[model samples]
Target: MIRLPDSSGRLRAYTPVGKGGHGAGAQGPAPRSRTVFAAAHVVADPLADTTPEGPAAVDWDATLAFRRHLWAHGLGVAEAMDTAQRGMGLDWEGAAELIRRSAAEARAVGGRIACGAGTDHLPATGQPAAGHTLAAITAAYGEQLHTVEETGAQAILMASRALAATARGPEDYEQVYGALLAQAERPVILHWLGPMFDPALAGYWGSQDLDTATDTFLRVVAAHPGRVDGVKVSLLDAGREVALRRRLPEGVRCYTGDDFHYPELIEGDAQGHSDALLGVFDPLAPLAAQAVRQLDAGGAGGFRATLDPTVPLARHLFQEPTRYYKTGVVLLAWLAGHQEHFTMVGGLQSARSLPHLARAYELADGIGLFPDPELAQARMKQLLAVHGVH
Candidate 1:
């Protein structure tokens, strides 16, 4: 039995369902029915200056090792993405090193890898002229894009907070993306991170209306079919994602970054299904890969059965203030023994309170995510005791 704090701050004891088994190790080949990438989180150097405003001090070994664990489960690695705390705490220099090291490591093991390219290096202050800002954003994207290609990894064009903060209208977005697409060494995945994830992006694509934003996005993709690969929709709204996916040009894929409604979206309908590049996949990799494998083997029923139970955990971890979801991701990593501690870049371990974390523990355990229940319980007790909960 485990004791947990409910949403109202009351402690409740419940027996954890113990059916969840160990990781489905690299027992088979990768899934073929759908392309999947787990947007991995970085491990912080707990001993470093990991304060809220301090520079990120990463545990490189642990960070890279987590990538290997994802690959071993036959899931591709989406590195240097939001899951890695790209804009939150991980600065451009750190992200560049992460990209280079992860790409080299992927090559060594023949693992699939893709790295984010974004204009996150810009100075945060009063902007220059719109044209100049656009030029600067373009240059920033170009620099990151070249770096990713040089490392021999696919590039995922991350949505730029700089661009969102600078652009005046849809024409600006068209100009920026159009220029970047034309110069790409290969097709790249465009990221559309909704405002919920980053409030700064509330009016992205030059319009607050999602329909207008979708039009602008499609226009950009339609303009450069061969140079564009797909768009990762992180809007969390499954219906909207489906609508957008159906509207995508021929041969362009939709990599679902939606955490709340992934199973249904990935399961898809007769129209089409979403491929995945999800942050939630970091903690749910083993189960996610197993479910995808079931789908590949023509057991859609089995796939649904395997993944359905995990939605509650995913939704809870990705609750409002979704950007802070990395805390829960790292929390699960510690409980499952993927890492040595519950530390995070930017000292984000405190983003969610002890009660919220206790709930995450309960949900993860309910799904049998922890290989050793006793160890998870002990960790929970330790954390609770730290919070003055005896």
Candidate 2:
């Protein structure tokens, strides 16, 4: 039995259910119903001498191995996404290397992969200065786009903080995205990450009003017909996502990035369903893959039965301050034995409170996510003991 701390600072006795042996569900064919990509987390080099402001020290082997694990479970890997700590700790150089390595690995394993292309390389400060012109922002985006396309991997045009700062209005956004789309060699996924995930992006699409922003966003997509494969909506608003998806042009997909209501969104309503490219799938990959397989087998009920129970866990991890959600993701990876340590790039292991992590462990264990319950329990105990929980 382990003692876990709750939000009230009270300790509760808990016994793990030990429901193991669901680890290797990735052997099945890809899901035919929806194209799902798990935005994976990067493993940290725990032994490296690093500081928060310093460059990210990634454990590339472990990171790539985790991608392989995701691919083995029949899920496409969304590389260098926010879940990988882009803009948070991972700089553009690290991200570029990650994209190259992950893309090559995807080729070797015959796994589906898409990489984020953004202007994160530009310095965040003095973004509105003379040096940070729209042309400069466009060039930065073009550079990253070229990196992704050169790897023969699909490009995901990630929402740019630089553009958000530099653009004066909707017209600037249209100009930048229009140029990038026109130059794209293949259809790219466009990501609309809301301000909640990154406060720096409050007025994305050139308006704080979502309806206006949606209009601008759709116009961008409408201007480029076949250049866009899909749009990833991370506004965490299910109704808005449904509405926006319905407005998308023919042959374009709407990939749900809403962790709060993914099951229903992916299961979708009568009109149509959203495909997925979620950060939550990083820790929930196995059960997620299983649920998608159920959906593929025309077992919507079974799919819900498998995935619905996981929503609470997903909501907990992606709770307020959703950007820190990556901390909980890596913690679960450590507990599940996907990575050997609970460390993250930029020493983000301390991002979540001990109680937050304890609850994450409990919820994940309740759903039988750990392949070795005993190992998970032991790790949880060690973590608790380190914090004087004994």
| Top candidate by lDDT | 2
Off by over 4 Å in 2: 126-131
Candidate 2 has its poorest 10 consecutive residues by lDDT at 21-30
Model 1 misplaced regions, further than 4 Å: 20-27, 126-132
TM-score for candidate 1: 0.97
How well is each residue in 100-154 modelled by candidate 2, as lDDT tens digits?
9999999999999999999999876764554478998999999999999999999
As a whole number from 0 to 100, the lDDT of residue 92 in candidate 2 is 97
TM-score of 2: 0.98
Q: What's the lDDT for candidate 1?
A: 0.89
Give one digit per residue, the lDDT tens place, for model 1 in 120-140: 887776543432468888999
